[model samples]
Target chain A: MGDPQLSGEQVRQRALLRFDRVERAVHWLNASLFLILVLTGAALYFTPLIALVGRRRLIEQVHLYVGLALPLPLLLGLAGSWGRGLRRDVGRINRWTEADMRWLRGLVDNAAGRRPSAPRPRLGKFNAGQKLNAAFVAGGGLVMLGTGALLRWYVPFPLSWRAGATFVHNWLAFMFVVVILGHIALALSDREALRSMLGGRISSAWAARHAPAWLEEASDQ
Target chain B: MTEHAGPADELPVRGAGAEQPVPSPAGDGTQEPWSKPIGRRTVLSVLGLGALGTLFGSHLQSGISSALNAVHANGIASLLPGGGQFTIYTVTSGYPAAPADYTLRVGGLVQRPLSLPLAELQALPATRLTRNFQCVTGWEVADVHWVGVRLVDLAAHAGVNPAATAFQFRSFDGIYTESLTIQQAHQTGAIVAYSMLGAPVTREHGGPVRLYVPSMFGYKSIKWLSAIDLVARPQPGYWEQNGYPIDAWISGHPPVQAA
Candidate 1:
C-alpha cells in the first residue's frame, strides 16, 4: 500500500504498518487486561487500608481471580509480539544514556516553561519514558507471574519462598500502577502519539518532529 | 478549526476527516459474532466474572477461616491423635529496630564462625523486596514491603563452610525453630528482614529481625529471628518435634484432610 495522505496542517503524511495486525492486537489486549489487572491488583494491594471499610474478603477474592487470570492475557500478548518490533521498542526504551538524565532535568524545568534548549536527541521508535515503562511492566510482569504461580500452587517451595514471593508481588504491583498512570498521562497529552497507537500509524510530520530517527528509518524502508 | 472545540466538536467523526481508522470487521474476523464490538457485553461479562469470583472467593475464605479456627481453637486435635499445644498472645504493633543494633549470629559447626551487628551488615550492599503477605490463619494480605540484606549477602559476608548441610533458625521466642538446606537459603527472595512496610519491624509481627523465605507457607518464615546456627547434622525444630511439616510449604493439602 502507498503512503496515506494527511489534511489538517498539510505538513505530515501519515505513516503506515509500523505495527503489524498481530502486534496491534497484542498491544490493545495487553492494554485492556493491564487496566483490569491494575484495578484488581490495587484492590488487593490496599487491603490493609481497605480492610477498614470491611471488604477484605471481597477484595482478596477478586485479587486472586484476577491474579490467576492475568497470565493468560499476558502470555498471549507476549507470544504475539515476542520477536516483533515491539520487543525492539522495549529494548530501545530500556537503553539508558547520559541524555536521559538531561531529559529528566529538562522535564523539571519544562514544567514551569523555563526549560533550557538542549540538543534534542534522535529518539528511535521508543523514548526513555516508553522504555522505562516497558521494562517495569515486562520485568515486573515476570516476577509477578513466577511468584504468583508459587503462591497459587503453594507447593514445591520452602516457607521462605512463599513469604518472599508475597512481598515482591505487592511491591511490584504498586510500582506498575504508578508507571501505568504516567504512561496514560503521556498518551493523553500527546494527541498525535495517541492516534498513532489507535490507528497503527503516525503522521509523518509528527514522527519527524518527535522521533526523527524512526521517521528516517521508516522512510528508508 | 477552533482551538477549543465544544461538545459538538467532540462528536465522533463519521466521514473522511476522522483522525483514526474506524475499527474494521476483519480486525476481529476470527471472533464469533456474539463477541463483536467488545462493548456492553464484554464489560458486563467481565463484571459478571468478577462478581462470581468474589462469591467463590468469599466462600473459600470463610471455609478456610472456619477450618483454621477449628484448628486454632482445638489445638490441632482433629489432625493429631495427641492434641497439639496452642499459645495465644495479644496483638502488639511497632517497627523493628535498625540492622545496626541487629546482630545475626551463625555459630555451631565447621570453620569461620561469625556474629555481625547491623552496621557491619548494612555496610555490605542490601537487598530490598516487596511481596504479598499470606497468613495461614486464613487472611491473604498483599503488598507487604520488606527491606533488608539477603541471606546470600549474609552467607557471602560470613563465608559458608562446604561441610555445613543444614541451617537452623532460632527466634526470640526461644520456642519456634525452622531449618533449611544450605542451598535453599540462597534463593532469590530469601532475606533476613530488618524492616517491613517501609518501617522497622514491629514486635507483634517478628521484630528485631525475621527470616523471610518466599515460596513456602508463612510458618516456615521464622519470626523474631535471634540466631542462625549451621550444623552438620539435621536437628528437629520445635515445630518439627511437634509434628508440623518440616518444610511447611503450601503443598495443596486440603485443610483438615485426613492424613
Candidate 2:
C-alpha cells in the first residue's frame, strides 16, 4: 500500500473502510435514539418542561417506546456479520496496551486543542478515551435497561430496592448526558471522523494521521 | 428507608373488630372522628368531582383539584399539575361490579365475622384526605383526594384477634393480594378507601374498597377489596411472589425477598 513516489493528493484519494456499513448504520441509529432519549428524558426530569412540553402524555409514551427500543439497532446489526466483529471490538476495547495509556496521558493536551512539540503516539482504530467512552456507555446502558424495567413494572419490589434502582438510574442519566455531549463535541471537532461514521470510510491519509496502527491493519486485511 | 417520611406516620392505625356496632373512639390512644350518615355533602362532593373529571375530561386531575380548591382552599391539592394518564398495571383485566351485590368481609382472625354491606361502610366515619400519589415509575398524581373509613375502624369493628399481628389484603379479582405488617397498618394514611377525588372509586381504580398505604407505592394498595386475613406472618402478595420487594418503600431499597 506504500509507494514513495505517490503525492499527498493520491494518498488522500484512496478510501478504506474505517467503519463498516453495519457499524455505521447501527452507530447512527443508536446516536439518533440517544439524542431523542436525552431530550425526552430531560423534559420529564425537569419541572419547567411540564408546561413547555405540550402533550405530556404523548411525549411520555414516545420516551418509553424509544427507550425500550434503543437496543434494537445493535441487535439487528449482530444478526448480520457484526456479531463476531462487535464482540471483537468489545474485546479490543477491554484490552489495555502501552500505546493506549500513552494516548490517555496526552488526552489533556488533545482536549485543550494544544499540539505539543513532542512526538505523538500512534493509535489503533480507537484511542484510550474512545474505548473508555464505549465501555462506559455499554455498561451504563445495561444498568439503565435493568433499572428502568424495574421502575416501570410494579413487581412489588421493596421501597429500598426501588429507591436503589432509582438512584442508580438517575445518576446514570446525568453521566450519560455528559459523556454523550463530550462524544458529540469530540466528533464535531474532527470533520473526517464525523464523516467516516456517516459514509463508512475515510481517506487513507486521514486514517494514517489519526490511527496509523489501524490503518496498517486495514491495509493488511 | 430515607428520613423523608410521608403522612403515613401520624394517623392512628385502624383495625377491624369494634364490639360496638357504632364506631366509638377506641381507648387505646386512637381518637377517631365520630361516624355520621352519608350526608348531602358527600353527594355534592361526588357531583363536583364528576363535573371536574368529566367536564374537563382531558384535564381531569387539574380540573378536579381546581374544583376542590374552590371549596376547601387547601393549597396542598392545587400545587402541581397532573403529569400524564394513570397507567393501570393489572395482571388481569376483569373487575367485580360495585354497589350491586357487594359486601366487604371483615373476617379471619377477628372476634366477629361481619359481612358489612356498602351502606354499613358509608355510615362509618368518612375521612377525606388529599395525597400526592407517587408511582414507582416516578409519575405522580398530586392532590388526589380520597374518602374512606380507617383500617383501625374496620379492625375495631371486627375486633381483630389479639394473636394476629399482620393482615393480608386479598382482592376479589383473584390475581392480586398484598400483606402489610402490623407496624405498617399502624401508620397514618392507612385506610380502606372507597372514594377518589370525591367520586366513588371506579372499577379501573380499584373500586368498592381498596387498601391505601400512603408510605408505600400504589401496588401495595390492594384494589378490589375483598377480605382481610390476619395472621402471625405476612403471606407475600401476587406481585411479591413475582419478585417485587416485600418491604417496598417510596425511597429505600428493601432487603432481598425472604426465602
Candidate 3:
C-alpha cells in the first residue's frame, strides 16, 4: 500500500505495472506514427498552413508515404494485442459512474479557480480525464482507418458521404493532436506519471493517489 | 482541497512513499524533471540535423519531379504514362455505365431548357484533351487523356441566356453538386468527359460522365455526372458545404493556393 501523506519522498513508495512492455511499445509506436501523419497530413490539407514544410509535390509525397506507413504500426499493434487492449480500454471508458462525474466537476471547478466544498474524489484505475483520452484515441483510430481506406481507393461513395468522411478525418486529426499534447503535458508535469510510462511501473504512493482501486487489484493479483 | 493560485502553477508533490530517489528542487514549483536542460552539443546537433533534413528533402523532391517529367517526354518508355502514376482504388459501388440511357438536362435560368440522350450528345462536335488530374487531398496524375464534349460547346448548343452567370452540375448520387462560373464552365480545357485513358469512362471514375476542369482541383470535376442546371448566381459544391474550399485551385505546392 502507498503512503497517503503528500510529500516528495513518499512519491517513490507507489509501484505497479499499469502498462506492460508490449503495451508501452505499441503506444509509443502509434504515437510517433500519429505525429508524423499529423505533420504531413496537415501540410497536405492546407498547403499554406505551414510554408516551410515544402512545395506541393514534396508535401504530397511525404503525405502519401506517411499515410501508407500508418497502417503498418496499427496492424502490428492490433495483431499483437489481438484486439484485447483496445477492447479493455473501451469497456473502461463506457462504464462511467457518479464518482467520475464528481471528479469531472471538481476538475472544472479547479480549472476555474473555484474552491469546492467537497474534497477531491479518489480515482480508480483512470480518472475522467484519462477515460476521455482513451475513448477518443480508440474512436479516432477507427475513423481514421476507415476513411483513409476509402480515400485511398477510387470507390465512389455518394458525394455527401465522402465529404462527411473527409470532415471526420480532418477534424479528428486536429482534435487528437490537441488531446495528445495535453496528455504529454500532464505526463511531463508529473514525475511519477512519466516514470510509470518509461519504466512500466508506478510508485505505490502514485497508484494510491491516482488509482487506489487499481493498486488494490494489482496487489491482489 | 488546499487552495492554490492556479492548477498549472501548483507544486505537484507525490503522496507519501510514492517519491522516487530523485532529488527535489528547493522551490515549490510544479515543473517536472523532464524539463531539465539538454547538453549544448545535443541542441546544436539537433538543429544541424533539422537543417540538413530540410535541404535533402527539397532536393529529393525536385529530383523526383524532373525524373517524372523526363519519363513523360519519352512517351511509351515511361513507367507511368504522362510522367505521373495512376492509382485506381476500387469504389464499393460498381462503376457507372455509359451510352448511358440517362439524359443530360440543362434547365433553370437558361433561355431554353434542353435534354439530350447519350447518343445525340456524343454526336455533337466532341473535344478531347490530356491534362493532369489533381486531387485536393494531394495526388496528381498527369496527362490523363480524356475525350468528351467541351462544356463551352454544350453551352453554345444550349444557347445560354446572357443573364445566366453560373451552372450547377448534379450527379445521380444526388448528394454531390458542383457549381461553376459561366467563364470557368466555358474555359478552353473544361469538358464533360465520357471517356478516360482511351476507353469509355468506368463507373468508379465517375463514368457515364464527369466534369473535367483542368485549372481546378479534382473535387470540381464532379463525377457520376447527371444534370447541368444554369443558374443566375453561384452555388457551393458538395465538398464546399462540408468545409472544402469552393474554388480549389491547384498551386505548385500545398495544392490550394493561399488566400
Candidate 4:
C-alpha cells in the first residue's frame, strides 16, 4: 500500500493501527462514564457544590445510574467477536514478562537519573506503567462498585460495614481524581499515544521506538 | 356453698400419673412436661427460625438506623422504601411511632394545659399549606400540601401565659427537639400537621403529627411531634446543638409571606 515514488523506510513511517474501532469506542465510553461519575459524586459530596447546584435528587439519581452502568462498555466489548483487539490487549495487560520487570526497574533508575546497567528492555503493546495503571483501574473499579452498592443499598449491611464502605468509596474517589489527572497529563505529554487513543492509529516510526516488540508482532500479522 | 357446682370436678388432671386414665405414646405419664424430649426436626426448625429472626432483626435495625441517621451523615436513606426522595433523619436509632393513646401535651408556661389527641387536633381549624420544604443539607420537596391546625390557634386554645415567649417541640422519638420563638410559631406556615400530600403523614415521614415549618429549613420542623411546651425562651434543638443554625431560613432569607 506504499506510493511508487516512496522508499521502503518512508513507507514504513506511515501510520499503523494502534487501537481498533471497538477498542477506541470502549475507551471513550469508559472515559465519559468516569467523568459523569466524578462530577455527580462531587456534587453529592460537597456542600458548597450542592448549594450552588441544587437539584440534589436528580444529581444523585444520575450518579447512581451512571455508576451502575460504568462496566457495561467493557463487558459488552469483550463479549462480541468484534472485541478481538480489546481482548488481546487485556491479555497483554494481564501478562507480565521478565522484560516487563526489567522495564519497571529501568523506569525507577531513569527517574533517579542513574546510568543504565543494561540496554532498555523492549516494550510490547503496553509499557509496565500502562500495565500497572490498567490493573489498578480494573481492581479499583470492582472495589468502587462493591462499596458503592453497599452505600446505595445500605439496609442489609451493618453500621460498621456501611461506615467502612463510605470511607473506602470517598478515599478511592479522591485517588481516582488524582490518577485520572496524572493519566491525562501523561497522555497529553505523549501526543502520538493520545492521538492513537483518539483516532486508533500511530506512525510506524512512533510504534517502533516505543513498542518495538508490538511493531514486530503487527508486521508478522 | 357452690363448691360442688364448680367445673373443676369435670376435668382430669393431665400427666398426673396417679390420676391419668391413659399415658401418651411419646412419653410416660410419669414424665414431667419439661422432661419430654424434642424431635431433631423440631429443634432444627426452631434453630433455623431463630437464625432467620436474628438476621431479619439485624437488617431491620440497620435499615431503621440508616433511615434515622441520615442527618448525621451525608447522602443516606434516600433509597429507603417510602422515604420518597426525602432523606429521613432521626436523632435516635429507630423511628418512634405514636403510642396507641398518643396525646400532644400542651403545657409548660400555659395558663390551661391541654392533652389533645390526634382527632382533637384534626377537629380544630385546618390550614392547608402548599409550599416548598427545604432541608438545610440542600434537598427540597416543592409544593407539599400540608393539613393541620395552626400552632397559633393551638396556642390560643391552650391559653398561653404571657411568660411563654417560645414553643419547645418534643418528639416521640425522644432524642429530637426543636424550638421556635412565639413569633415564628405564629407564622402562617407553622402548623401541627397531621396530613401531607393529601394523606396522613407516614410514620417514616413523621406521621400522626409533625410540625410543618415551611418558612424554615426542615430541621426546624420537628418529627414524631409529641409535645408543644410553651416555654420562656428559644432553646437550641438537637440539630442546633450539632452546629446547625437555629434560624435556618431557606435561601438565607425568611419568607416574605410564608410562601
All candidates: DockQ? 0.02, 0.01, 0.04, 0.01
> Candidates sorted by lDDT, descending order?
4, 2, 3, 1
Instruction: Give the Cα error of residue B113 in candidate 1, in Å.
Output: 60
| Candidate 3 or 2, higher TM-score | 2
| DockQ, cand. 4 | 0.01
In the order shown, the candidates' Cα RMSDs to the true structure are 21.3, 24.1, 17.1, 25.8
- lDDT of candidate 4 vs native? 0.68
- Lowest summed lDDT across 10 adjacent residues in model 3 chain A is found at A154-163
lDDT of 4 at B230: 92
Compared to the true structure, candidate 1 yields what TM-score?
0.42
Between candidates 1 and 4, which one is better according to DockQ? 1
CA lDDT scores, all candidates in order: 0.54, 0.64, 0.60, 0.68
Compare candidates 2 and 4 on DockQ and give the better one.
2
Off by over 4 Å in 3: A1-14, A49-94, B1-259
TM of each candidate vs. truth: 0.42, 0.49, 0.45, 0.50
Best of the candidates, TM-score = 4
Q: What TM value does model 4 have?
A: 0.50
Query: Highest lDDT among the candidates is held by which one?
Result: 4
TM-score sort, best first: 4, 2, 3, 1
Angstrom error of the Cα, residue B86, model 3: value is: 23
lDDT of 4 by residue, B193-223 (tens): 9999889998867888999987687888888
User: Which candidate ranks first by DockQ, i.e. highest?
Assistant: 3
